[model samples]
Target: MSDIYDLITKRMDLLTREKEVFADNILRSSVPGEREKVIKFKNLVTHGGATPKAQATGLKSTNKNHLSLSTHLGSTRMTTKKTDSDVSLSGNTINAEDQLRKINDATTKYYEMTSLYQSYMRRHNTVITGR
Candidate 1:
């Protein structure tokens, strides 16, 4: 009877340790994923532009005189207007700045969770090793 009771208690302790280790692993793994998202969103917030390829094509034309001076000036004005409107529309539709903010918040939360997990692991190890 004592042998059976001891076996059951050891198994329960093993399972509890496994659960704690699994939770720590999950917290550790999630940090890198969140960091990647934070980097991607930061790039989008900093460098993402709303200008279309068609407008860029005009600027990259090989032929210098493909458009008359007046027409070129008009095109430039229109491109500026289009770019402004596209920026406003993108701000409304995608809200890259807000998305970046949320990503930053998530990254901070992940870091905190990982730090807590590390602290728990250190405490567990100390208890297990008696050092």
Candidate 2:
């Protein structure tokens, strides 16, 4: 169980790094207008929530999952643009979006797993300590 915990922690750390990398790539690949649009979309998605100010801060989100919602929003926008036009999507943008999505999905899974492990540990400790 300790080994499993260690593995989960490592995976979570890796996912965090991966998410950051993808977010950076998405931001780098986006034009100024596209960036603005993505920020607006992200704000709308997270509107009236705890992180309403995320839009003004370089597309960062305050969500606990450590996944950057901006990347997903940008990806959606890129897909829409591609669909609206007859031209093929830029490979770099598509790849970055795909990577971001995969990283976000993995981050969510690892976060849930880590939470469950922590809960189990707390229960075990409570039984052992009888407190």
Question: lDDT: which candidate is best?
Answer: 2
lDDT of 2 by residue, 1-131 (tens): 57877666655654555566557546655443332112234442545322433546656656757776544323322112232322224333224456568667867877797897788789889999998
TM-score of each: 0.32, 0.43
| Candidate of highest TM-score | 2
How far in Å is the alpha carbon of 101 misplaced in model 1?
0.7
How displaced is residue 16 in candidate 1, in Å?
Answer: 26
* Clashes within 3 Å, all models in order: 0, 0
What are the runs in model 2 whose C-alpha is more than 4 Å off?
31-91, 95-100
